[model samples]
Target: MTSIDPQAKFRTGAVDMTHGGGGRAMAVLIEDLFHRHLKNTILDQGHDAAVLEMPPGRLVMSTDAHVISPLFFPGGDIGSLSVHGTLNDLAMAGARPVSLTASFILEEGFPLADLERIVISMARAAREAGVPVVSGDTKVVEKGKGDGVFITTTGVGVLPEGVSISPAAAKPGQAVLLSGTIGDHGVAILSKRENLTFETEIQSDSAALHGLVGSMVDAVPGISVLRDPTRGGLATALNEIAHASKVGVMLDEGEIPVRPDVEGVCELLGLDPLYVANEGKLICICEASDADRLLEIMKAHPLGQNAAKIGEIVEDTDCMVVMKTGFGGSRVVDWLSGEQLPRIC
Candidate 1:
């Protein structure tokens, strides 16, 4: 057994092959960095696999791999983003997240300072979400073969009885609600990547939605669908739900919210805000009769204060997503053909 010095600080030096060789260096790295910040009862067990006591309900599991560029962005970094992304996935299923497991792929010669920063951020995000990372693995790749670091997080949650939501559950006459303004996350990343500046700095809307989701489910258990518009943005998310439910989506372009600065950046770059990414937003689908009540509940939460009714589900065998323009014309909101704003999550 390799003895680790708990008092060791990685203020300098870079990660090397020895850190991932399963030796004393690896032990010191895990103890002084990862475990130091992310310590919890479950993780402290030091078992290869965590033994969990699951609550009574259906188990919900989601895995997300984050490879965002410019690891650090205006509002969040890879660490926080990884935690938020996976938790939001569980939240979209109307589940209460219980635990998370993180796996890291580090490149040789990566700075220990940056790694420590990311670990601290991840720990803070997990603590704020009331979720613990119970187990994880780490590996190092050749310097040229890997990016600085890639984080893959797997989240496990519990779905309460009598609450079910899915993309396929959307039906005709369902109201489509948006949690907040779109395009913030993508635009923020683009600005940072391209070295562009605007009148006001656009910050990524990265956040965990489980709290808002819990309240919404408690208020309206009949919600048909809940999805976060991430990489492909609102257009792709709605199209996906439309195809899954075999329904058509009719959206009022004017009803959707977009920040003025975000719109300006997209326009300058010849990109459409509708297809830009968002991290802290969600699309909620429910019966038209329950729309008002659900919207009220959403508006009451901090994460959903900007919620709005942007569209509705209609009967259509073709399963298309169409938007009514402000000019009184309608157009098909097609799936994003190729990657727009790559490495945006």
Candidate 2:
């Protein structure tokens, strides 16, 4: 039997079914590509599983799969989105992410160069967030059976004592806060979609929010709800929280932040910015008394510089999300009926 070359250059090479055969090809791909970029002490152990000491606190775990179209976008790609999305899930639960595990499904004939670029980007994002990818698996599919690549990431974190945050904790009379502008991510992906062009490039707001979430938890331990509006955007996320807490949301349209460019793009495409997705923004539901303080804390963080108090929880049997229009009319902000932008992480 011939052994795969560990030192073989992959610049012009493409993934093949043998890479996922759990043989020499698979070993070389894991050790040379995945390990070469994401290697850590635990991962270096090369065991089938990673073992670690658990911190003295409650644990939080979240997983996400990334299948965004146009692997590369203005400010991010599926790679970074996979890391940020998973970490943000843990952050929303008031957890300090400790580690991540990634899984990749690569299509045969997919360019090795592109795969390496995505891996490098994922590694960079994890490093910037102070979380390491401790374990991962790779598989190759038939040439036409899979998209270029799909990444699945699972993240784990520890929650501090006395910090309890959940959608069910929301109560009437609580204030709602937004970490930053909306629609940036959705529009960014739309702009970069094949044959879709806009006057200016709109970058995805994809980022790891655990740092900002940590600061908020420190400043206001009693925060009721912390949610990042991702796929369904602000409207759908708010609706979910409302239903969970059996409350209503009253939003001031004028207070919600939307970039002028993003607004224009939404209007041009006949899309509602409220329904558009955002990768880096969060929705905070807290006691009305702490709203001002939480807003201040959020604004101080780089990721929360555009933080604004956009709404408040209210009593409503219907558990609806209502937005006061700029023109003095009120409208219901309903759950997104269908995918506004498919394949958006």
Candidate 3:
């Protein structure tokens, strides 16, 4: 019979090669740790694959990797982030995420307890999003060959007909809307890093935006483009769309949403809030006529309560994002150079 405490040794020590050597150690760990938190019929099938009953619609897929330093941070961790990040990507395309696949690369000496904690968090996040991790793979590298752990997640979702949105579809006279405040994710990550001078705590707005996207898509099927501002922030995201769609934008900086604390932090750090990353926000470009209806839908949702109409597309030098300053000046919002926040998911 298997011992009651299969991870007894692993609990008190670091991972060893033998634990993944296709032996008793490996069996015990899988059955004891993974099976405990992720008990489901599909996983129990366990024949090198997860059997799935997928729904009908146009299939949409997205993949993302989570490697942010300080895996555990305010509002989220690498585990929850892995789930939300990929889910949001699919949602941006108006897809309903159904299943996910997770792959883990672990350092040889990482703690088994921490690994278990991450897996539990991943399961919880999937449940909250109404998605499931149908399958996964794990590999171990030499202690120094990898970080504590890095996760790559792939998600498959379904998009309803008549709901097509793309960056190339952005057009002139379209109104631009931002879901909520900006720069929360960037400041949150910076605050947690050492040698950075900051007193107040700032939590990362890392969340899955699928629910909000669904509401918007249902309310307005004619939306032009939907992009989640992630590593490069909102400025770069809009620029990409401008070049792809051959459109120009005139943005009002005062209309863009930014928390007072976030604004203060950016000023203190000499960082432009427009260049800051946001994981929980999105940029939606739609026709001028549809803006009012869409704004109503957005304001009703919790995630988009602070939503605002920030700009409008126009015919000008294509591929240019022009921002009208609050002080009556015009400036171009360009892509960020080099890495402002490295390892930011």
Best by lDDT: 1
lDDT of 2 by residue, 211-316 (tens): 9999999989889999999988999999999999999999999999999999998888999998888999999999999999999999999999999999899999
Candidate 1: residue pairs that collide:
none
Candidate 1 residue-wise lDDT, 1-345, digit = tens: 545333444676788988899998897888778888999999999998999899999999999999999999999999999999999999999999999999999999998888999999999999999999999999999899889999999999999999989999999998999999999999999999999987788999999999999998998988999999998999999999999999999999999999999999999999999899999999999989888988898898998988999999999999999999999999999999988989896
Error of 3 at 99 (Å): 0.6
TM-score of each: 0.97, 0.97, 0.95
C-alpha lDDT of all candidate models, in order: 0.94, 0.91, 0.86
Q: How many residue pairs of model 2 clash at the backbone?
A: 0
| Candidate 3 overall lDDT versus native | 0.86
Q: Give the clashing residue pairs of candidate 3, or none.
A: none
What value does the lDDT take at residue 158 in candidate 3? Answer: 95
Give the distance in Å from residue 328's predicted Cα in candidate 3 to where it truly belongs: 1.1
Model 2 pairs whose backbones collide: none
For model 3, give the 10-residue run with minimal summed lDDT.
1-10
Q: State how far residue 114 of model 2 sits from its true place (Å).
A: 0.6
